[model samples]
Target: MDLLIAWLLTAISLLIIAQLPIGVEIDNFGKALVAAIVFGILNAIVKPVLLVLTIPITILTLGIFLIILNAIIFGLAAALVQGFRLRYGFWSAIFGSVFLSIVNGLLNQVVSR
Candidate 1:
């Protein structure tokens, strides 16, 4: 139940992010939902491993490297998911990931209350 809510919130966040002219594009709600699921799965499975591998760099950057890590995962999702696109490569992925994180956080806060 909680997982469902998180997925829906993530889908909503993706749709909202798509509205911005930030070089991230989602063709429709269906694609956004699919992308959200993919993003969640990647975050759960791949992100942790990547984080561990980059811990030294992450420490050197005072955790700022996580943003680039997030962007890489975001770009990976765009590549894997149909109808979701990141038009401007790494920069687009970075900004899109940041906005998505903010929107998802806000939505989760509202939903939790």
Candidate 2:
């Protein structure tokens, strides 16, 4: 199914991101899969509410605050997963989220076609 494919792709993207020097680390594919699920859940549930609450700051910052919000969610996901970690704290989360987005976009494009 499409949802299964997307989940696997997200896990793969997490693994790819871990291989980079961006301070995101995943112990194995299993952990990557778990992290991906948690990340997806948090994005789906928490992100929208946070976005609404931070509208003023987001507007003031020209939408740049979304990056910080994404990093916070990324860090939260890492916190909830045993084998997934963001080294260097918030800085790592910021880079990890950015790279994750990039890698996911690339992987989805390949998988979709």
Candidate 3:
């Protein structure tokens, strides 16, 4: 149940991010959940691989390159979810990714209390 709420909050955050002046829209909550699941799975599975591959770049950029990697992962998750539609451009996805991450972090912190 806690996980469900977290995913719902993530979906809501994603929706808001999409609705921002520079945002996009997720058409269905169910699909958004699926997107979140995909994101988690990918983050656990592929993220480390990507991180390893980008080690030099990440080191060179002083870890700032992780932001771009995160955006790419978020975009991939959005693409995997059919109902979580993102008509916005790359910039919106980047911003939306940041928006949702921050919102999720805040919510997690509060909910864990």
C-alpha RMSD for every candidate: 0.6, 0.7, 1.9
The segments of candidate 2 whose C-alpha lies over 4 angstroms from its true place after superposition are: none
Per-residue C-alpha lDDT of model 3 across residues 15-71, encoded as one tens digit per residue: 656667765677766766777788788788989999999999999999999889888
Clashing pairs in 3: 18-24
Q: How close to the true structure is residue 90 of candidate 3, measured as C-alpha lDDT? A: 75
Residue 23, candidate 2: Cα error in Å is 0.8
Task: Give the C-alpha lDDT of model 3.
Answer: 0.78
Q: Which candidate is the best by TM-score?
A: 1
Using lDDT as the measure, the top candidate is 1
Better lDDT candidate (2, 3): 2
For model 1, the local distance difference test gives: 0.96
Give a tens-digit lDDT track for model 1, residues 1-113. 99999999999999999899999999999999999999999999999999999999999999999999999999999999999999898988999999999999999999999
* lDDT tens digits, residue span 7-41, model 2: 99999999999999989999999999999899899
Q: Output the better candidate (2/3) by TM-score.
A: 2
- lDDT minimum window of 10 residues, candidate 3: 15-24
